[model samples]
Target: MLKMKPVTRQKVNIVIDILMFVVMAALAVIGFLIRYTLISGEARWEKFGSNIEMTLFGLDRHQWGFIHLVLGVMLAVLLVLHIVFHWKQIICLFRRLTPLRPQRYALVSAITVVSLLILISPFFLKVELGESIRGQGERGGRNVSRTSGAYLPSESEDRTPLSSEVLNELPQTQAIHQNQNRRHGEARMLEIKGYHTIGTLAKNYNVSAAKLKNTLNIPSDVSSNERLGRIRRIYGFSMREVEECILALQHSTGDQTQHNNSQ
Candidate 1:
């Protein structure tokens, strides 16, 4: 068997330590980038405008998330290697901490079991849904429904225009494009969220509310004012499917426009 020299082993340990540190730092930085800078679409719209698209280094949040995941995998692998390399030292330390043979083995087994449970906990964790999308009511975004806590918008407020307050809150660049409402002559896609109501989506995306309901298979009895998230919970449909349907509707609209121009 090929055995590493003492010097070679020391150098390998140093390399491993350095790589682990670098990977950990990178992981933290990317995690912050995803959480704050490249925030969720819903957050972006609330902070900026629905028209605004946030990106860092030309990569969207999802792309950054992929890189973040890769970094996490690398960190986990490096951690395993680090533990393997220092296994003898670990055993010695445990022996000093718990001198009894049976106790030492029990301590080690308990720690190993705890570490594994912690690692796998995320997969088994339950995800919770939040309140459905509510409309901006005339009473200053207050007065939610008694049953659902959702603000029922009147016909005039149903297609609520971007309020001046919201406009003022936008960044200077976003403020400039607020009125233009054009994205490189292409239709913009809004990020679908549970809080979004069918009416709000239809009005914002320039699709008919009836068509939107039909596409999503939301029954006529289900109010358009009800939040998409609530509807999904009741009907059992993925948000991805909703987004795809919206995109398809936009594409069909664009195709019709092109056909008309060609005639």
Candidate 2:
């Protein structure tokens, strides 16, 4: 093979810096899309309440998170290489900023602390804002429970959260959770084996969809294709209780129809 052009140290550093810029820029764009597009509902698919299964760039958010981590490691390595290339200039700049003296150590320490605080400020800001909006805020750590969908469990029903053993014992209950990763628009509520969405169940039982949404505390904007088991889990209600409620209304409707027909 013909000998290629001789590589130089300066050229290598320049190439690494360029690659770093590209990686950082790409990460910035992806981070913005993940934080804003996903939260702002501009993403192609609706998120399932903190579930990371929504798609972007042909990959789910969980997959994207892994990619982001790998890119982050690459960026860090490039940064270290850049520092190695510029070690002399960095030493000179540090000397110019502050001489290595015992009296100057406090000033350097203060600068480092302040710089770190500034770099991490956005995270603290988000936490404060979240607490103000939806967390246990100025109420002295007291959290106000949401007012709507406050279904009190009857004496015969259990309001306590399910134990893992009890949950495992419930037949078919694990099936919905196992298949929770079904893609958007691929959820086939009516055809899914032994699983049903609130809308489909309501329609079959001749009950109002709005009633189902209200009684189950499901969000109104939730798609009709969401499985009933998923909604029950989200709303912290017993699946058996909801199913019984639906069956009761269905039987009552049938009885009324037969009596009216006889009259």
Candidate 3:
């Protein structure tokens, strides 16, 4: 029988810590990217060459809510592990603080307390948070509408017409054209109202935010209203009635567009 070398518990613990740290770091980065992309309305590529759509479980806004819930649980678990591994250091730092250094202690305590409040506020307040130190709802240009689709404009006056020349200039225009060819060479224009954020759009469409973006060939990072404009330009559903017609066709026959013999 071959003798097996015993692995020290400390070494195992170290390995676990290293692995956990790597995972935690990755999760943090992913979470940050997701929030940033959603808030800023954009996308990023991961090391594995996957597109993280600022979405949950790779789904759209509604789907992302479920995904966010699951990810949040995983984040809590990782956070616990991080605390467990660093408890000794944390305790030591606390112990080192003394009344003699009242200012130092007060400063550290204030910072810690503020940080804690910032971290947990989103959960309690029912608002999304971001990595930026600025408080939630303070970010400029954030307009959330409950009734509009994900890409609808926040204000009626802010709405802009889709421009084909602008579309032709995009870096992904060639790829879009190729994809467009598969459906039809023609593009439709549409203007939609209701739902100002992707999350709202996902809920209204009964699809994931990611799917809507993918289906419309809109980048995850684009602003919500801009994305809607792109879809409108691509599909020629410039009006609500036309959009309704397209949707009706999709529901009635699973056909996005088909020629009518009468026409």
Name the top lDDT candidate: 1
Per-residue lDDT tens digits of candidate 1, residues 1-263?
A: 99876677778888999999999999999999888887775454344334246678899888999999999999899999998999999888878989999998798799899999999999999999643332211211222222422123334333343443453465423432342221122223345667888898887777678766776777888899998767887886655446445544553454455557877
The lDDT of model 1 is 0.63
- TM-scores for the candidates: 0.48, 0.44, 0.32
| Candidate 2 displacement at residue 104 in angstroms | 5.5
TM-score between candidate 3 and the true structure: 0.32
How accurate locally, in lDDT, is each candidate?
Answer: 0.63, 0.53, 0.43
Candidate 1 local Cα displacement, residue 186, angstroms: 22
Tens digits of per-residue lDDT, candidate 2, 40-149, equal 32122122321123577687665666778889989989998998999999878877777767646777788789979986896787533221111111221111122321
Per-residue lDDT, model 1, residue 232, is: 80
Which regions in candidate 3 have their CA more than 4 angstroms from the true location? 1-9, 12-22, 25-61, 90-100, 123-263
Q: 41-75 in candidate 3: lDDT tens per residue? A: 21111111112234445555445445556666675
Model 1 misplaced stretches (Cα beyond 4 Å): 1-7, 133-263
**Candidate 2 vs 3: which has more TM-score:** 2
Q: How many residue pairs clash per model?
A: 1, 0, 21
Q: In the order shown, what is each candidate's alpha-carbon RMSD? A: 17.6, 13.8, 16.4
